[model samples]
Target: MQQEKESAEEINELWSLYGENRSMEIRNRLVEHYLPLVNIIAGRLAMSLPSHVDRDDLIISGYFGLMDAVDRYDIKRGNKFETYAGIRISGAMKDELRSRDWISVSLRQKIRRYESAVVELEGRLGRSATDEELAERLEMSIEQVHHLERQINAATVIPLGEYMKSEAAIAVDTDPHRSAEYIETRETLAKALDELTEKEKLVVSLYYYDELTMKEISLIMHLSEARICQLHTKAMFKLRGFLANIDGI
Candidate 1:
C-alpha cells in the first residue's frame, strides 16, 4: 500500500513535470512509468485468446493504448489515470484482435443469428431463456445449439469486454457525467447476474471479476476447462441479452 501511494505520488509529480514542458522525454517517462499497466491488461486478455495469438503482440498493442492515454489524460478531471488508461489499453488490444480476426463470414453470421435469437426470446419472455427454448426458437437440434455455442465461444473476447467495460471511444473524456452511464451498466449487470445459474455465476465471477484464467477456474470448480468455458459463454450471453433489452446500454 505504501509503495502504491508513493508510486501514485511519483506519477503526479511526473505529470506536473510534463505539464510544464510537455517534452517527449517527460512523456516517454510517463509511459515508461505505466508500462506495467499495459502488461497487466495484455496478460488478462491473453488468457482468453486463442493459443495462436501472441501475448507479446497484445503487450505491444496495449503499449500503444498506454501511450494514447498518457497523451490525452486530463488530471483536472478528477478521474484516476489508471482507470482511464485501462480502457484505452484494453481497447487497443481488442482493436488489434479485430484487425487480425479470423472468424469467417459464415461464422460471423451464425454468431449474429444466435445472439439475435437469444435477445429476441429474452425480450419476449421477459426472463432468461432456457437452452431447450433456444433450440426450438432457432429450429435447431440440441446438439446444433451446443455447437453454435462453441462457435460463439471464439467470439467472446471483446464483446464480453464491451459488457464488462466502456469502449475506448466512449471513455476518452472520462468526465463525471459518464459516471451515470457506468453506474447504469453496473446495476444492469448486477441484475442480469442474479438470473444466472449458480455454476454460471461462479464461472463469470472467477473468470472475470476475480481475473482468473480458465485453467485456474476449472481447477477451483473441479470441472474441465472446456466446461468452464461453456458456463462463461452462457453467462455472458445471458447478461448481454438482458442488457440489450435496456435502452441506451
Candidate 2:
C-alpha cells in the first residue's frame, strides 16, 4: 500500500511538470511512472478483442493514450490524474476496437431492436424473462441470445474531459458581458448532439439524461443488458470524437 501511494504521487508529480511543458526528464518520468496503468487497462481490453487481435498491439495503443494523458492532464482540476488517465487509456483501446469494425451499425441496430423486444415482453409478462424465454421470443438460439446479450457490454462512455477542462465553457458568470459566451457554448453543444447517430443519441439519453443502469435500461428497452452496455460504449466513443472537433463546447 505504501509503495502504491508513492507510485501514484510520482505519477501526479510527473503530470504536473508535463502540463507545464517542462523538460524531457519530466516527460520521461511521466511515461515510466504511468506505464503500469497503460498495461493494466490494456490487459482488461485484451479480454474483449474478438479472439483475433494482438494484445501487444493493444498495449502499445493504450501506452500512447497514457502518455497523452500524462502530458495533457490539468492541474486545476481536483480529480486525480490516475482516475482521468485510466478512462482515456481505456477509451483509446476501445477506439482501436472501432477501427477494427467490432461495433458496426448493423450490430447496433440489432441491439436496439432486441431492447425494444425485451421491454415489450416484460410489459406483458410482468417479470424478467429467462435466457430460454428471451431466445424463444426473439426467435434466436440460446447461444445466439447469450452472444447478443454480451455484446451490450460495450457502452458509450461520456467523455467528461471537455466538461472538466473548460470551467468557463459551461459555467455561468455573473458578469453580463459573458452571457453571450454561454449562449454560444450551449448552441455548439446542441449542434454537436444533433450530428450524432440515432444509437448514439439514444445511448446519451438513456445513460446520461435518464441516469438508467444498463440492466434497467435493457429491461426498459427490451434488450439484453450486454447490448445496452455496448450501445452506450459505442455512443461514448462517437461523443468523444465530436467533443474533440468542436471548439467551444
Candidate 3:
C-alpha cells in the first residue's frame, strides 16, 4: 500500500511538472511511467485477435494513444489517468484493426444476415431461438450456422474501448437528469443478460467481466474452445438485438 501511494505521488508530481512547462522531458517521463498500461490493454486485446495480428504492432499503435491521453488528460475532471489512458490505448489499437478491415465484406454481409435471422426468429418465437431453430429459419444446415457464428464471434472480439463506444454511445453523466439515461441503459443490459441461458451467461461473464482467455474459459467450463466461442457469439447477438429494440441502435 505504501509503495502504491508513493508511485501515485510520483506520477502526480510528474503530471504537475508537465502541466507547468509542457516539456518533452517531463512528457516522456510520464509516458514511460504509463507504458505498462498499454501493454496490459494490448495483451488482453491480442488474446481475442488472430495469431497473424502482430502484438508489437498493437503496442506501437497504443503508444500513440498513450501520448494522446497524456496530452489531453484533465486533472480537474476527477477521473483516474489510468482509466482514461486505457480507453485511448485500446481505441487506438482497434482503429488500426478497423483500418485493416480484417473481416471481409462477404463475411460482414453474412453476419448481418445471421443477426437479422436471430432477431426475427426470436421475436416470432417469443424466446431465445436454438441453433436448430436458427438453422431452419435461415434455411441453412446446423453446421453452416455454427460456422457463421464462429466467424461473427471472431469479428466481434473487439477491445472493450470500442465495445463501449459501439454498444453504449450514451453520455455517462453524474447529474440526476443525465444519469437517468445511463441508468436505464444499464438496466436494459442487465435484462438482456438475464435472457441468456446459464451457459451463455457464464461464457459472457468469463470472457468480458472476468477477462479470461477463451482457453481458460474452455478449461473451466469443460467445453471445447469452439463451443465457448459459439456461446459468446449467440449471447452477444441476443444482447445487441435487445438493446437495439430499446435504443434504436
Q: Each prediction's Cα lDDT score? A: 0.78, 0.62, 0.79
Q: What is the lDDT of residue 245 in candidate 1?
A: 62
Off by over 4 Å in 3: 1-6, 76-78, 159-181, 245-249
In model 2, which runs have C-alpha deviations exceeding 4 angstroms? 1-16, 19-21, 103-113, 123-127, 141-144, 147-249
Residues 226-245, candidate 3: write the lDDT tens digits. 88988888888888766765
Worst 10 residues of 2 by lDDT: 155-164
- Residue-wise C-alpha lDDT for candidate 1, range 82-116, written one tens digit per residue: 87888889988888988988677998898888878
Give the CA lDDT, 0 to 100, for residue 193 in model 3. Answer: 81
Off by over 4 Å in 1: 1-9, 54-56, 76-79, 116-148, 167-177, 245-249
- Count of clashing pairs, candidate 2: 17
The sequence of per-residue lDDT tens digits that candidate 2 reaches over residues 1-249 is: 223333666666666667677678777666676688888766655554456677887788888888777666666656666767776686677677667766668877876767666666755876445567778988999888767756654422225333432334233234555665556555656666775566557766776555556677788778876766555544444444446654532
Give per-residue lDDT, candidate 2, residue 64.
85
* Superposition error at 32 for model 3 (Å): 1.3
